[model samples]
Target: MGHPTPAAVWIWMFPLLLLESRAGHLGAQETEMLEGQECRPHEQPWPTALFQGVQLVCGDVLIDDNGVPTAVHCKKLKYTVRLGDHSLQNKDGSEQETAVAQSLPHPCYNSSNKDHNRDLMLIPRDRASLGPQVKPIHLADHCPQVGQKGTISSWSCVTSPQENFPDTLNCTEVKIIPQKQSEDAYPGQVTDSMVCANESSGADPCQGDSRGSLVCGGVLQGITSWESDLYGRPERSGIYINICHYLDWTKKTMGSKG
Candidate 1:
């Protein structure tokens, strides 16, 4: 569903939990749509697996004078992802839900390197409190092995004018392009810490899907960031911030006190 107007985040996906509409009608619709759907969680291919919903950003998140993304910066990690059930108010008789992310951003991130690409961060939450429908995914250290396949998942709003909530969650498959990790290349210098993926041809990610996850091996590996715009044409390439390099940083940042 669309986020309330004026708060449009070019790449942000609205969690079903925060929809403006009531619970019963939307919940029923979601259930019916998901019925018999072939898509399963974390089963998608690489590169695409790196797409994840970026959450809980702070005011310090900057944009350049030209409107290009300057960084994936945030002042805190109060942002969260909801799984299994989509209500801010925990339901009665509902299974105990868990908030698995217990981490934060790397302290050394500079907000000027368009290529640093080190913006979003995550942490493993306590799984012992997890509900039946909620669980964590795996993270990969590099781009998928040669010819690896991945998928990009999002609760993309398909409805028009984006009233409080969109009608459904949308998913599509994309392939991970094979590239080398290097220190002097465009995405190379950060390749060790980030990964990239795309559809072979014709297919591409869209607006309102930014910060969505690109998952692989059941773990979160990358974050959807910027994409190439050929001026008036659809986006050609999508960028993501690699998570592996900052895994340690996440732990350290969240562990610090102000």
Candidate 2:
């Protein structure tokens, strides 16, 4: 799952949010992530049934008083993403539905600002364990070369310009904009764990795209960080976690087989 878009007005659009909990604060707020009232652009539609088998869930997590991961909280909301098989959602030739079980944002991610650093997170469904149909997305250890093209997929609103919220999984290709490495952040606010892509202003992430995948060379690179401007602007910015630099950290944290 993704962090809450901090813009303010974006939160007001999602009125159905299950409020009453601490995480419910965002139910009445609106940010750049939710701008379009209705009518999305044609180019920004959800992917075909080719990815129909996979189920997408949206969840949120909270830190405990001791700063330890207390429990995995689940959400009633679910994104319409298909992986490889439609059977998961098929009920006697009909459709089945699933929701989010638990979502854990990176420990270093500061949702209060969401400028940069540790923008990626993990989402797992309690009812549907990581199985063949629903497998963990492969993490890459390298970044895409300059000018290289890649695909990003997610069930966020950015995918569909027509709808104010996500109705299905959307995927699109973007180029890796060449960026100069510097000890100092280039964008003035970017962090060491973040990288830039797609210099073209209109080719960036937009509203309803938080926590979606920034894929390149078959690698899940970044997540929808923030929009450069609100009100459904075309140009946007994303905050991606430096996956290659954090391989060791992930293995240790997730107990990978190596």
Candidate 3:
């Protein structure tokens, strides 16, 4: 799973997005964590690493054991879930790595169709243990307001022509903006389920940075979905699936674990 790239148009390209059409670019998106500083060890206890076996696929949120795994991009393949990981290359001994028994993708997530909403999933494992360095975050109850400040945690590292997928976590500050920007940038692809944001501290999101958390007012409000290249067009904004819009679905879907 990775950030969406230049489509001549805008797209919320799959990091864990469930589209075979989108999976082809996963290798390119895996290049680096976008421009940002390193996150303190375990500071982002809610993020989990998703791997198609040994290879890293994307980063997801750990809301208890009910982590938000997005997309059925590879519907046939299962993922290895790793939590409490500060460094991907070097384990700090606080990591909880396990294989999930099953991944419950949103029943409505058929990205092959005109549907891109409901991309998140509730993953369960036979034995999933939480730790001091691994914890759950509560999803924001309300939609994010325009101009609201938030923090985006990313593992992507993209500094212009240089690209390196850093082992450590990274985070940057962001702000919610009007959806009109999304509409202007992405055209017909923008949906009400999605919200828009712009970089306030670091550079705009890139590959290896999406599908992570967008926390506002201290709650998980959204997930990184896509962005247009703002290198020249600074008016363009990144898109995130507003968690508040899907709160009912997530809770009901997660059921007892929620």
The candidate scoring highest on lDDT is 3
**lDDT by residue for model 1 over 69-109, one digit each (tens)?**
11244223344323332222334343232332344444555
- Candidate 2: 10-residue stretch with minimal lDDT: 62-71
Least accurate 10 contiguous residues by lDDT in model 3: 8-17
Better of 1 and 3 by lDDT: 3
- Counting clashing residue pairs in each candidate, in order, gives 30, 20, 11
lDDT for model 1, please. 0.39
lDDT at position 30, candidate 2: 31
Per-residue lDDT of candidate 2, residues 18-44 (tens digit): 444435555534332332222222222
Cα RMSD, model 1: 15.8
Write down the TM-score of every candidate.
0.50, 0.50, 0.77
Q: Candidate 3 on 166-226: residue-level lDDT in tens?
A: 6777777778888887787777877998887877433556632453668887788877666
What C-alpha lDDT, on a 0 to 100 scale, does residue 147 get in candidate 2? 73
Scored by TM-score, the top model is 3
Indicate the residue-level lDDT of 247 in model 3: 83
